[model samples]
Target: MPGCNNNSRLSAEEVQELKQICRYVRKMIINTVADAGCGHTGGSLSEVEILVGLYFRIMNIDPHNPSWQERDRFVLSKGHASPGYYSVLANRGYFYEGKLADFNAIDSMLQGHPCMVKTPGVDMSTGSLGQGLSAGIGMCLGRDKRGLDFKVYVLMGDGELQEGQIWEAAMYAGFHKLSGLIGIVDYNKVQLAGTVVETLDLEPLADKWKAFGWKVLECDGHDIGEVVDTIQKAKRMSESGPVVVIAKTIKGKGVSFMEGKFQWHAKAPSESERKLALEEIDSCVE
Candidate 1:
């Protein structure tokens, strides 16, 4: 672990190091997208910090024991954001970092979306929208049945909330009082076609989750301290239902030209654009 200090817990310095890791993760994402010739860059970049916070700071996971009974489960509901997820997994020692160079190439383990069968650390194969929460709920229910203490965390794109199946899962989780489950919404507000408001507004989103009987929390996704603190708080809250963390974030956060732009949602950068994006992300490293 290049950034790992001796502590088992994430210290202030470690959090800072993780932030640097996120920067490199963003750079790797930019390079991969550039090579892939097509990808969901905006959403991927927007969720990088949150993924870093989870994989490095929050989640209790083991790369060596991926299927360990006590390991927490993470489901990437926004599967198109796999670039961020894969980058974090690689940095966390899930696989060889060199394999990242072959991202999206023919015969590569990294497809455009994450595949659990191909990827070492992926818990579930996901791409279809609105299904991850259900899978997470199943895991939580299974753990509860087995009397296990593990938790399940799922990340969903804000636009994915438009899918009716998500609400069904939410209703079930709340009704069953699945307290072991946590769902984080990446509220970047930009989807593939356009801004979420233009497609299907998820405004009053947190309230909807609360109404569904979840303990809801909101935070700035880019703030590592806030991300860690909120998730820890959510874990401690006494709730007979699921928890939802609404993470407000900017699409293409680190790159000025791509920030808040819908066009970058599913488009790859050209070589020139990739050079600029890499330089911009690199400037944030230190």
Candidate 2:
């Protein structure tokens, strides 16, 4: 959506474009799950702005050359959010939009989880949760070893943080000063079962990252401008150590009926529900 000036600074028009893309991407996520009859609905919807903000404005990526060595790398640690990830990748021209209909099918490149071998733009195979950060840390370290310059971004679910491995990876990143690594927590608070706090609390979350030796930042994940600005801030300050942005987001962001509802976590909409969902997205003010 943003101009290819290749930096995070957003013009008014670019901000508007990113917002429009968010709406488009959200609708795509809804339709994708509705078509498939099953998918991670709520989290996918929740992550539209975060993914779009990175893909459209923040990261230096090339959809045409998905594996270009010089391109930036992005890892979707919370792989159940593949609907959002695939929607953005398809819309960004990593693959055909029509292919989204085949999502999660046995032979489709778009799978329930990201597979770097199957998906053109996916940088890592993720879905096990709490492991993406570890892979991302390796990627960042690899860049140093190869004398290459590129940033690694890992998107993890807030609930996924409950996995002990996440903290272990955080500790490694901090101890090694992996400044090129950027960690994004989709802090929607709602998980598959219940609210994150009600399940396993992550209060004092920012402090946890700071204590791990990271420069922690927080933002409204639904706001594209804030997402871009905060990510750019992370990049600018990353030399201090790795950075983590705890993005506060709504569980089901763009759709009124699904917003903040944990039951919608992995449910597809009925035909009537799909109609209502698309209408709701269309009704949004661009």
lDDT of each: 0.85, 0.90
The list of candidate 1 runs beyond 4 A from truth reads: 1-11
> Residues 1-286, candidate 1, lDDT per residue (tens digit)?
1222122445789778878888889998898788778778999999988888888877787787677778878999999888888888998899987787777777789987889889988998899999999999888878878988877889999988999999999999887778878899999988888899999998788889988889899999998778877876776662456899999999999999999999898888999999999989888754
TM-score list, all predictions = 0.94, 0.97
Model 2 residue 126 distance off true place after TM-score fit, in angstroms: 0.6
Candidate 2: segments with Cα more than 4 A from true spot: 1-5
Residue range 100-203, candidate 2, lDDT tens digits:
99999998899999999999999999999789999999998889899998888899999999999999999998988887889999999999899999999999
TM-score of 1: 0.94
lDDT of 2: 0.90
> For candidate 1, which ten residues in a row score worst on lDDT?
1-10
- Candidate 2 vs. true structure, TM-score: 0.97
Clashes by residue pair, model 1: none
